[model samples]
Target: MISAPLTRRAIFAQAWPIMLGQTTVPLVGLVDTAVIGRTGDATALAGVALGTVVINMIFWTFGFLRMGMTGMTAQAEGAGDAREVEAMLLRGVVAGVGLGVVLFALQIVLIPLALETMAGGGALDDAARGYVSARFLGAPASLAIFAINGWLFGRGRTRAALALQIVMNLVNIALNLLFVWHFHMGARGVGLGTACAEWISLAVGLAIAGRGVDWGRILSPALFGGGALRRLFAVNADIMIRTIALLSLFLWFTNAGARLGATALAANYVLMQFVSVSAFVLDGFAFTAESRVGQAIGAGSRSAMVRAIRLTGEFSLLAGIGFALLFFVLGPALIAFFASNPAVRAQAGAMLPFAAIIPAIGVPAWLLDGIFIGATRGRALRNAAILATALYIATDLLFRPFGESGIWWAFMASYLYRAVSLGAYLPGLLRTIEVAEPANGP
Candidate 1:
């Protein structure tokens, strides 16, 4: 095992790049929002908003492709298995290409569904259609890029991953200006620009990740064995189910918030901004745990894994505390910024305590998620999510007397359940590692 100091440095080295990458992710969306909003034609802005939402939903669902590949690639790297690494990348590309083809084929149905979801008025329908059509052309590139980035991240090349994203965003921004402003192509232009850049980014990612890969070896029938294919499909399927469950909770929260009076709903919306910000920042540390733990598992180094888990816990605790402090001190101001009416502002401020506690509460679950993902314990993760989700629905129903405060309480319980459930599962995981080590029977 490496010394604590070295492990800490390694964790930071891995974590910081991911933080920067996560930071840039929202910037592209903000730029899209800004550029599209400035067009003066409200219909065009509305169209882009609806169109992007649809795009986001579609892409986010397949995020398992990236996450599922990360653990595999990291393990391959730790095992020093070059052929496995190549196959990991190639497998993702194949999955992504296949999925993208399906997405392209379904656009005829998806585009209209997107419009209906946004409650498309006739005025904005055409504009939304234009944007959706243009973006569909790039679905393949986008999904494929997810796989490539995941491989880069798993291989501990987060800086390279960051560079690819930064370049993609820069290209996206530059083209947004050129096509939307200069050419006045409107919604279609924004979609086209993103598509073009993703295609470019894929080329860049492939060039970076694909270097020295033995495509000849990868093309061999031996490498594309049945076992690898099954593992890949199984891991991804588990993650996809978990993702769906997780997303469903958020949607339920939102839908329930809407059912509450408009003022309370608005307050909850702003309050959620705190959760979103904390999540992005905290994900950096989670990512570090993922890479280090995967490497440790692959190398059969329990000491290294212990060091990683400890360091990650320390970092997560500090971040959770820091988030708690911010939400306590600044929550009112942040809430006030989004809450227009005095009633909404006051109610939101009242809920600051709920919001304030979530970061600290959520630390364990978030940190553990990284460990689970790294270890590829998808069944455990999936089980935890299922239970947590059920607890959330039950809590919400049980606490209806408290109104909006009740909803927030339900969310808190759900987070706590996730942490507790996962923490309970950790011992079994650790025992497995212990049993596997020093016996020399394998």
Candidate 2:
């Protein structure tokens, strides 16, 4: 019986918890910016902002644990392979923890290189170092949580995922207040709080996962054998490279803003927050795409995957539009809330329209990303990213004479290109799958 693949109720059931969970993430950043900005020190603010970006680059690069795990595990789940799901979780957690160890070991060299690339050093460098060093403490725990979260999402345990995230973020915020406000610990305090929160969340996730699986059955020598290992590495490596390329573009954006100096950097930093918040919202639907699409494939239901994609993509689009409108209406107030420095505020206010336009353009790009991840379409993603990034660089150069607005234009255009590029490829990919089935029935 071919029917609608997903209902609005089904989509909402999946999306709402993810959205609510994600909402708390920005609160941590907002709190950090508000508390640190209140210190009336632009240099410190810029350092923390820059530090945050660097930390994200390092951590997010390993985001393959979450993404790769989610797709694989969700498919296994839909196929009713409980043992495979367990192995997937174990593999992700193992890889994540190992990568975290490597990151911590390499941070000393990595931090300096990242800083110099941004032309960051001096007063700004000192504060950023303080912040990043503190964050480094939780690398292992943070990655562990990534693996844990991915597994939870794969199982369609959205509410549990939501609870874990909310607890983690709340812990971060509380500690941020204690250290930065009361103890006057500065940027280091912010980092430490975030680190501690990550470890705490990992503990909670482990407890939940423990209740669901027989660990003795989940572990096996074959888990690391030729076929399974090769698949894991191949999938994760693709996603990792894709992630690195994407992060590089954003890092380059921040670096460009840095060359414009502290005020511009700070302003750009705050504006990116709006972008992040919008992403978080749309990501709710993206996640749904990952779960539902993977599940449908595992169950051999092409119609289900098609239906899930349509519903989730539409939901993401609507959510994105809402973000754009919110930014347009309240851009200034939010900018003001983030920065007390007059110059930073002024610069950010001028760029407000660009910020407002991001979600609208980002809607399709983000939706496609989720779709791709669900289908495990890494090569396509990598190709699109390469093409989009090349164009983005060229666009940035072409608009250089116009200064920051030019940069903003280039940024906006790059996202549009990403969407158009991915959106174009998606239909062809779907057709192949659709054609693989009988004209009338599966």
Candidate 3:
């Protein structure tokens, strides 16, 4: 069994890398908004915002690559089965590539659908289309990078995952400046920069995997046969359902903001970036929980699993508190950084408190996600998420009389519900662990 002190240190060591990596996407978004805001074009900002909603929907749908792979690989690592570990990595890559291809094809038809659905026949429509089309070009590489990241994290190499993310975001940011500012490519430039960065990061991630892993075993055709593919698909499907439910809430919120007005939509968009920052940081702890819990489960150590849950949960709580305070102290400055229009900044500032409230209410659910995933209890997670999502939609609809503040309040309530409902299920989950354990075994 892993020692408690060693496990605690190792968990953080792994987590900080993921935390740093996760921080980059929002940073890039914040940068993009800041640069575009300087162009004095509200439409450009709106376009990026709308386009991101679409991209996030598409990309995040396949989050199973990271979630499923982490759990499965960690379990294999804990079980001391190198072959199974390699198989999990191989399966993730194949599935990621196939899914990417499907998403890319759909984008051809979907882009117009999204543009029309979001808003049709105007500058907003034009900008959104341009951004979506350009970003779609990188679908394959983007998906590949997800698989690579999952594989690395599964291997307990959070540092590698972190490095790849840093490289990808840094490159994307630099290219964004060159294309958007120097080349004057606007939304398309930003999209192209993101796509290019994904490809470059995938290349680097592949190199790292090759150096660190036993690819010969992983790539065997026997392991890539129908049974392996079917299992991976099953896991991914459950995760897809869970992710769809999760993302749909955000999508609906954005759509609702759009219905309000451009300024409200933009304000919501900017504030959501702050929420993303918290979510990403919290995800570090989630990743730690997944790896450690999966490892414990794989090794058939109930005590270790319990310890991991406690330690990771504590860490996540602390992180959430830190972010909440950070938002309270520096929120206005952060808002100013993203919005050049004094008016936009003022609007976003008004909403910053709502954003700050997310981590406090949402961190528990986030951490539980990793724990349940490590336990391979995807069905439970999918069900709980769907329930929470249903409540979110219901609450939002009920709060319609109160305007945006009401909507934000409902959003906060949704996170709280998710955390509580998921937490309530933990006791039963622990009982299952006890039942699964051999009477006298570790």
Candidate 4:
């Protein structure tokens, strides 16, 4: 078995690299916007923005590949199943690339449908369509990279994962500048540049992931047998459902903000940046929990598993409190940084208290998600998401009379529901290690 010390220092070692990697993610979007905006072409900028939303929405549907790959591979690593570890990556890559191809093939139908819902017709539509068309070409690479990154994370190769992210972002940024500034390809260039960067990153990722891998084990028929594929797909499907349900809650939140008025919508948008920032930072601890907990489960060490959860949870808790304090102290300045409109700034400031405490309130839910994901408890996750979402919507409606503040309260309520609902499954999760095999293994 893979015996690694489970300690707070180990948790920090795992988390910092992930946090650094996540920090670069938002930079890519900023670069995309900056390169496009320099031309002073509002239509092109808006098109690129809308196209990004559409592409992200589509790609997110298959995010299960990344999460599932990490869980399965981590478990295999914990079990000291060298063969299974390699096989997990192989299966993940195949499924990722295969699903990406399907998405590309259906781009004609998918792009326009997504655009119609998200954008108006004419030049804007055409610009968005152009951007999406070019970006869609890299769908396979993008998805494949997801699997590769997942594998790296599972192996606790956080430095490699960090390098992979930095390479992709830097390459994308450089190419975007070259395409927009030098070639004048507008939104199409932006999309193409990102697509090309993804492909290049995939090449690098493969070289890294393939190092010392046992091809014989990965290519074995037993590894790709019907039973294995079924198990992988089952976990993936459940995670997908869970992801979609969670996304719907946010989408509804955004829609609700819109109904409140343009000011509220804009304010909420700015406020969401706070939530996003916190999530990005907190994900480091959550991801650490994933690998550590997965290894603990795989080794069937209940104490290790409990230690993993407690340690990671503690770090996340402290980080969340830190964020809350920072937001409360610098709330206005940060609000000003994100918003220029006095009205928007004022509204966002009014709502800042709600956003400020979210990281703290939401920590348990986020940490629990990582714990369950590591355990491969997909059914528990799926059920909790559905129930939590339903309660969120019900609470939102119930709080309708309070307006925007009520919505924020309901949003907070969703996090609580998710934690409580999933928390209910902890006993069963712990009991699994007492058995011969994990109850929820893929």
The candidate maximizing lDDT is 2
- Candidate 3 colliding pairs: none
Alpha-carbon runs more than 4 Å astray in model 1 = 1-6, 29-57, 110-137, 172-197, 225-227, 260-274, 327-357, 399-405, 434-442
Worst-scoring 10-residue span by lDDT in model 4:
433-442
Can you write out model 3's per-residue Cα lDDT over 16-87, one digit (the tens) per residue? 888988999788988888888778677788888889998887788888888888877888887788888777
- Compute each candidate's TM-score over C-alphas: 0.80, 0.95, 0.95, 0.86
Cα deviation of 47, candidate 2, in Å: 0.7
Clashes of 2: 0
Estimate, for each residue in 183-249, the C-alpha lDDT of model 4 and write its tens digit: 9889899999999999999899888888899896578778779689788888778888898888778
User: How far off is model 4, as Cα RMSD?
Assistant: 4.1
Cα deviation at 47, candidate 1, in Å, is 8.3
Note the clash tally of each candidate.
0, 0, 0, 0
Off by over 4 Å in 4: 30-53, 115-134, 176-193, 258-267, 334-350, 400-406, 435-442
Error of 2 at 1 (Å): 14
Candidate 2 error regions (>4 Å): 1-5, 432-442
Ordering by lDDT: 2, 4, 3, 1
lDDT of 1 by residue, 1-442 (tens): 2112336777887788777776666556556655755444545655665566567667767877777888888878777787788889988987887888899999999888755654455756787688879989988989999889878878888888878878888888888778898999998999999889988988898988888888988887765577877788887787777877776676567556555644455466556667766776787888777777777788777766777899988988998899999889987766555444666668778888998889898999999998888888888888888888888999998998988889899998888888988788888877666423455521
RMSD of each: 4.6, 2.2, 2.2, 4.1
